[model samples]
Target: MTLSTRPPAVRTSLPARMAGRLTRLTWIDLVVAAAVLVVLYVILRVGAGTAVSFNPARVTRVSTDPADLPYYAARSLLRMFAALALSVAFTLVYAYAAARSRRLERVLIPALDILQSVPVLGFLSVAVTGFIALFPGSSLGPECASVFAIFTSQAWNMTFGFYHSLVTLPRELDELSRSFGFTRWMRFWKVELPSGAIGLVWNGMMSFGGGWFFLVASEAISVSGHRYALPGIGSYAGTAIAEGDLGGVGWAVLTMAVMVVGVNFVFWRPLTAWVEKFKNEQSEATDVQRSLVLDFLRRSHWPHALGRLARPAAEVLGRAARILGTDDRPLSVDPVRRRGGDAVFALVAGGLIGWGLLDLLGYLRDRTGLGVFAEPLLLGLATLARVVVVVAVATAVWVPVGVRIGFSPRLARIAQPLVQVLAGFPANFLFPLATWFFLRTGLSINVGGMMLMALGAQWYILFNTIAGAMAVPADLREAMDDLGVTGRLRWKRLILPGIFPAYVTGGITASGGAWNASIVSEIVTFGGTTLTATGLGAYVAHATERGDYPHLIAGVAVMSLYVVGLNRLLWRPLYRLAETRYAL
Candidate 1:
């Protein structure tokens, strides 16, 4: 109409406009955003209540309202996450130290072994007193103590995982890193960390499972005449059991189950899937795990936005690190100076050890005679016997089953969560029920305790075996199939050798956990009745309750000795054998 010189009006198409808008929003995006908001609200609510007075007098006076369950759970989760963060940091430093220095490794590795073998209850006893004194008159003190206890339960295995990974890194990769002239810091972040990620994640998951078994004991602490009932699911369960409230117990169990599932979905699944990138054996055709949450994060604009926000701080950190970093060139020190330093270190260490031995001897002589150690030693032997039987039985039962499940990817996907849930279930929760049955049926406490230990420890063997089987090389599997390997011969020649290393790792963890669980399992209480078995765990628990510090220390020391001895003599040898003969 008009052949007017004016240009036609530019218009945007509806589909194009809609597509632009859709790029900013997906179904997963909305879901994740909503989840974030809810989590933030819960965190704020929990943080608000954390301002309570640190009155030791009020530690035992805790609320048991069902409506407070969510708040309590949030608190417990905060404590656990805090402890886990600390554990991860500790593992990185401790493992790096051990891996980088042969001199330190000799001391550090054995020290870690002893530390891990120390039962959680033993740590709780010492930690509670010290933390309370440090934060006198504040709830924060006991809270810190509880977190420390959980940390002890979680840190050791993760440390071992990282250390083992670092030490076992392929020689080719090590040489490559060195040839590239990577600085120490760069090598750690780029090479060592990635190489160890898979083991660290798996062991971290196992550590979390182990932490749950001690959560109740940590939260509802009653040692050295100090009773603290922290507001958490653990304390809720304890209160429920004390009052015989079946409904409360059911509620607590349901809440715990929900929490475990949520963690698996939101944290572990994503982590496990993400760490596949770090696997040394990953091939182009390897079907890595997929997680919807991880996928959403990867695909969404949120990651880009977060990266942009963090870039400035990261750049600052990088600059500072580079400024302070040492050169990669090897340093040549005078032989005389090096020898002097080594001599000084040796003398200091010897002096400390000698002083400790003298102090320990004097304390034992004055407070508790040497003869008094005989009872706990005998009790330790009894516990050791039970651990041996339980581990043997668990290995027999779970090895074949785990191998079978591992062979089926679909079955493994299903069984993994189930096993995790089972592992997370606190053995103490079953004590009241088991105690009732044993009391009614007149079953021996020793037998019941052994069974309970098995229940607590079997998951380690099963999970490790499953992982070992699943990790079997696809080429090896194909070769076996082509060779027509089957039946007992297949298991004897292929399966056992393939999983031997993993089996040794699992057995060590399971044995340690069994010893720890004995503190709870060897002593069961239902109402006014208490059933105790003659074992080191029972000895420690009784002494702790009585506030008998001397015996408590002695019992813990004895238990530690046994654990260290067995690990050094038995597990260490087996591990070395596996590494030399069976490792892929």
Candidate 2:
């Protein structure tokens, strides 16, 4: 303690002070971080730039070569980031609406079902035309098509994750927020969003993998007789496949694997760690809420600045809340002013759909005649065949494992990320490899397609099943234990029934993913041959290649309509069964 008094006589060295400061800016660390940011910004700038029309013929000609690898990888990374921005925007709105309104949940859940079920090729086919029309005079139309393709791949899982988190609020968590009279915005940010952390993270991971499933079609743009490819991983792979270059495929695969692992480490890991920190630990009392950021902010300069600004912001938000008719009262045990909500929602939805259809028909008549239309019966069969095979395979693989892991929280946590990593991996990376392996072995096109679809869709079953399994009541588990219901009996009587809701949810989501994946899966480029099977996805893919806008719209419309009708007729009833039978 006396050392300070004696040390006052001793002067601190300037060199020591400078050395300490310099240590903070370690050359290695500074360079690496700065380099990463610079690289990322450059990639983003290029991605957001105008589309480059690299000749498709040249791409085909040089398919298996290693020359354009860097050019293509850079391009794909840009598109991936762009797709990410769109996905986040979509997730925010969808999650918010589903959280806020019951009627929206009803309409949107079905709509999402249809959206997800419609194949990616169908999306590309229709979206390519609509997007082209929007930017009628430029290459922007092709870029828009590519962006939409990415959207189809990534949007569904995130939407479901957000939706699931909103509706599955723990009673205590809801009550705690209500007691504080948190505003709708505060409730969403502080409560619903946090609750959905696991789901959102899971979805983000899945969306990344799902992006891979569509990379080929997104990059290798073919409209009518004109084929355009922007340099990206998909384009590179497509070229590699065309030329039968094993080395290029191998390089792309290695690069993709490295990129996936690195991204997960940097972004997903830290985010997961932060979320895990917030997660309620078993030993911690339920009432305690330790918000690390909030605690820091309370003591920081920003909070004081924010405090000065709060009143004006509050007033604006207050007025908005009043107009929305949301009261400042505590959470009601019963419903609050629920009348006419459904009717209003229904009217709005009907009005929008009516407007959309009329506009669509008008555009159709002007652009192309009705004589080119394909019959609905054939479309339906094609859709059905794809759905049946995907569902069957997904169920068989994910069910038992999902249930097993669901029962154990530790296992579920570990397995969840593994599944996510698997989900994010681009299927295109595998196509060349799969093509190489299958062609030499003489496997059929159908076999390869099924494999591709299965890769994308299987995670849905696993994830949803785990969610359902975790939702099972502890008391029920205890009762089953007491009754000596073990092994097969336990699974049959307790686990299956307990997780039925999640299974249905998983099945619906999986079916959609499978359909989306089928486009690329059904069409294979291997050993200089492009192999395709007859399916709605194939039809849509062909139409997109042809730049046949009318046919494209018709194909997408049929698929979307089929998906919607099927959900209403089949999955809706199953969801009802789960809600009534299992929901508390």
Candidate 3:
């Protein structure tokens, strides 16, 4: 046997080389970028009343009536913008740390695990007081707090996506960066961030949906016996639900669907396509090959001037590095160091459990004769029951369907958009049909509401599992096929195991979404009668209506504890399985 080795071809023509060197960015594009920045600044300054006198008093009154739709819409848009910026920043920071520093990765990643598991309501309870105090008599502070609540709803999915991308980069590419002695900052910008782009887009889409799920509670706050309603889309939804107006709810749903579609078409599609161009299949750039960005910088007078200035700064940095004997070698790693990771996670879990117990004991002690604690425990049980039913049903239906879709790319394309539209459909859109069906069939309102929660949460598992299934290596699939795998045997032997990690990711997110959606789902009203389920969601909704703080806290606490416990017991194990079994 003999082995043959040959050198690869390189570009010969100057024009062909130049065309490849310069990425095409027109002057019009630069103008557009500048215009966007200018317009955003102007809007933030004037429309938001931030740059001028900045008077909350002069910001005009916020009416609870539907007549104030424009006011609330504008506020919601502002908060959405803030949420996007914060999500991007946090994702970059967390993803970078998790990728580059093992010690920081060990501590922060698990803390993020616990933080993400905590509900948006739980976040509000802890932060609302300090957030409000930040402005101390300004309405803007409360407004910003609402934005932070939205941030909590959106940030976690993005963090996970970025973390996954960071850990999963090609080893050859990582080694290449080390060989070149790329600076930490250069590696982050040129390598890590761009590699994470596709995952970030998907996570960003999920996070947007997550934000919408909790919009109602995030904008409306109740703490320490006080009720504060900020102007936003959530308040709009809450009002429509309260008034039993199907038409109004329909309008809101339409607006959301339009926004989702527009965002996907305008932003996500192009971003995905661009990222795909840089995947591992793409040819590597050699040093002898010219880059357009470099050529452009060389030709431009401004860049030449900047380079002249930067040379001295670069020299200073180099000298400092030499004097300090700084090494640029890549760090060696052992996955077994995750043992310490598990210990840190256990400590956080123990603390949260202890806090919940203390609160429960205090409630019992303080309300011995008043019977206040009774409602919370009963409500907690009802919340648990609803979660169990919805999750069990959702998983049963979505898991098999997801595996099929994953195996067929054409099916996945069709199903993905349909799932997106379905997920975006608000619970209120189905309220009329649900109310009518329940009334006609004499079914309890509770079951109907559970349907709404399940509708939203179920999709997460299906889509995520499908993503996981698609990730199964072609070699593995071919091997199974060659072995004559079919039907249940295929699912058991190949498909289920392949997509289990994605299922866990989806399930974790969906479970949290169900908890948030339940607030709206567990309470039903058609016309004159309001049917309330025996759950924390119903309790909180009712309390919000009557401005009852003690009961609201009780409901929030009950819901948060369940969410935390489920994450620790169920989702945590699944996450470990994914990391160990399927993670790249």
**How far off is residue 562 in model 1, in Å?**
0.2
Give the C-alpha miss distance for residue 228 in model 1, angstroms.
Answer: 0.7
**Which parts of model 2 are misplaced by more than 4 Å?**
1-71, 125-144, 278-348, 355-376, 403-421, 429-448, 466-486, 489-502, 577-584
N/CA/C clash count, model 3? 2
For candidate 2, give the lDDT. 0.69
For residues 1-584, what per-residue lDDT tens digits would candidate 2 score against the true structure? 45554535666699997787566654544555566699878776775655544222342332444566666666676677778889988998887786666667777777787778667766665666677677765557767788788987888877876675566566778888878877776777677777666556656666777786678778776667666565577777666665677787787776666666666665654554445433433333222222333343334444354577987886786678767867554443344445566667789899999999899888887887554455634855765676778788778878999887766655654665566667666676677667766778888766567777788788777877765665555567777878998988998888888777667767777777776676667777766667776677777777777777687787777777777777788877887776556543
Predicted candidate 3 versus true structure: per-residue lDDT over 315-432, tens digit per residue: 7766665566544544654566666766787688779878987887677557553366568668777777877888889889988887776666556545656666676555655666
Clashing pairs in 1: 54-137, 54-138, 54-139
Where model 1 places Cα greater than 4 Å from the true spot, the runs are 1-27, 285-287, 304-344, 405-407, 486-494
- Residue 79 of model 2, lDDT score: 76
Whole-model lDDT, model 3: 0.66
Models sorted by lDDT, best on top: 1, 2, 3
How badly does each model clash, as a count of residue pairs? Answer: 3, 9, 2
Candidate 2's TM-score: 0.75
Give the distance in Å from residue 127's predicted Cα in candidate 2 to where it truly belongs: 4.5
